[model samples]
Target: MYHSGRLGIMDDGQSTVLHDSPLSQFADQTAEFLRYHVLSAVKLLEFRRIDWELVGRLGQVDRLQQLLGEKFRLVLDCDAPQYYELALEFHSTFQYIHIFNMTLPQFAMATGFYTQQEVAKPVFVSLLRGVMKKQQDHCVMKEDLARFWVTIATSPFSNNMVASDIRDPLYRFVHKILAATLIGRHEDDNKVNHHSLFCLMCMVEGRPANLASIFAWSMTRPKKGGGKSRMFGGPYITWLADNLGVFVDYPVDRMHTGPALSLMELKSFQQAGIITCDTPPAWSSIVEGPQVQPPPGSAADAAMQAAIPS
Candidate 1:
């Protein structure tokens, strides 16, 4: 059934899913759902699923209907496609940042220390240790995050892996998700989720969050796949080159940074003391290739192409 990774049935059966092919959930996602609802290039990105519960359990919490929520939306009618592309970038960015901000400490324990030998060990390690101490019950304070960003942003050990590209947008996004979401009636806004913020910072840069090139995409996205091949017009690249440039000068920076790493780098980062793994992550070599999907179009498109089955 997954031969094409999509289903063509049009009936909106109670269990049937309304999917976007290329399934824009921004398109082409998991095969378990119906994949016949391609609308247009300018489509809506409904809320996403986190799948926190244990795998292989029966009954999903956010059934198809729940994922297609009623409140938030991003509609592109006459808006330039550049904005549309930017929206996609933010969507990916939000997912990654939230996950990391919540789990800041745990992530630090694992991949945080291995800064690729970029910094003076004593100075950098001390800063990293102080940063790790800020995690209070998995959630960090707003100031905490600010300092955190500074710690990594100033360090060469975390380049490209934590803060993504250029750092400004991530500042805005971190506040939006981490600080904003935890806010409650003024006096009670504290506890946040323990997260892999480093991983997320890398993602915010526009390429999918590959995490030292060892993790699978959190879900299917950046369908272009990450690597030297995936960098040309990625969201972050466009942002820096098209919008602003600092240590990065668009094409030049693009070439300098090299493209996103492939799965092979996982083995490269497993230094004796750095990664300290007895066994490799099963996901290291795994890469998500885009799947064959339903054609991109809307009902009008189908009608126009319809040679009704007489």
Candidate 2:
């Protein structure tokens, strides 16, 4: 659904399904690629921008079709008379449904808006039912909600069996921790860190061929407060690179995957326009010519604390 339906321009604002269609086989293949090769929920969420960028790359229906030839069968419905009406209906529901539904109850719970549970439940349910009715009246709402609910429940971010098979797991069997952070943020307001996802997009844009590899690198390290002791893994480093927009052209030892970048290489990477260095950290004493400072609360600090345990 994500790769073939959501990413495809032809399927935008259209009915997206996973069963019994020419696109089904291609959807299955895309699912397999994510399952067999991708790492964790964090990696998946980190790559969400790439998904959007891919759609942007093929803005027009014909262009998308050309780029994704034989990958799926897509029939664009540009002339569908119901499109405008359905769009208006969906927008109206989006505006009013939250007043009585989970938004209010969840907000109350989260923000202490209401201390009494009994008062919130019935109100929330009543609002949710009304919203559901409105959604049913609009074809777009029905389709969009179905797609959103399906992915929300059964996506790689879920704890279901579908996510466990992914090659490199994180958080010791848990799912959706880091991924949900960004996904939830995106669903709510459309901006997250601004630094993180943007950097990931730029890196992938810089070297499209190394996307999967970089994704793999990102999964190797779980995010902070991940309930795991170890820190600064391969994937985390990659994420840091994207988050900071730092060009790390380190020496690629046989065992090391571009680890230990030299000062000159770092400068060259910056100079080559691989990354935009905005207010990069400045160093006065240059024993190494360009010193690399570890991020706060990193693995080294954690290890040192463990050693002392004071």
Candidate 3:
């Protein structure tokens, strides 16, 4: 005979017992309910025809908020795909309020979604920090980084107090990416440079002083050969060459002076596409490769003959 305990346990004669704590049982029940009802509610709310007034009257929004609050940890920490889906759905459906209401730390954890939406200063800072830290991870996806940059460029975070607050981190991030590109460790160097340049441009927009510093930094970097070259080959360098007008006229005389290439030389190189190089081209080839002549009446002749016949 089996003996049952108050804690929902059964002892089958031996000391070995099967037990389920009431708390654990309650948690399991709660998870099941969320999996069914909460997830369904999110799905229903995602549809276009669903009336928001009706949804509010039905208390679906309140129910979702309650369920999400209860299962926040479970949904975020779980490795299951469905749990992630639920989190994303809840986030997208209630983005306006939920994103703004969450604390910075909480926003950081859900940056993958927050970054895709409009973000305020605190949320932007949190997302930027999250992306920077995530980029350091070995398994971070390029798409995630790309999305982060896109968000930064398109959002209103730039040209405001938020930009001033996050400027140091932004500069550090750009410097790290530039260093990687110079070392040739980055696989898609061109793409990385393009995104990085856009980010910097947005950051320095309406601020010529910041633009001057970035311009000087690019021009002052060591060249491929011995002395400093104005037209060094890199993504950032290329961007500077194209946007030379923005930083050219900035009065940097009062500011700290360094071993930067002169504005005249930069403009010359930009206009003439000429670089001061000591070495000549090595192993130059013709613009077009040697052409090959086809065999007289080869496959073409055979196909024509076959088409004319059977």
Clashes per candidate, residues 3 or more apart or on different chains = 14, 3, 0
Which candidate has the highest TM-score of all?
1
Give the Cα lDDT of each candidate.
0.26, 0.25, 0.27
Q: Which candidate has the top score in lDDT?
A: 3
Question: What is the C-alpha lDDT profile of model 2 across 1-310, one tens digit per residue?
Answer: 4333222112134422222222212334443334322211111111111122323332433443342222011111111111211111111122223244444344333222233463355433332111122454211223333322232222322222232222211110112222222112212221222222222222212211112222222332223222221121233333333333433332112111212211122232233232235565221111122222222353434545568856
> 24-56 in candidate 3: lDDT tens per residue?
112333433333232222211110111224335
Candidate 1 segments exceeding 4 Å error: 1-115, 119-140, 143-310
lDDT of 1 by residue, 4-62 (tens): 22222322332212232121243334322222112112222211112223111213223
RMSD of each: 26.3, 24.8, 29.5
- Which prediction has more favorable lDDT, 1 or 3? 3
Give the per-residue Cα lDDT of candidate 1 at 249. 25
Better of 2 and 3 by lDDT: 3
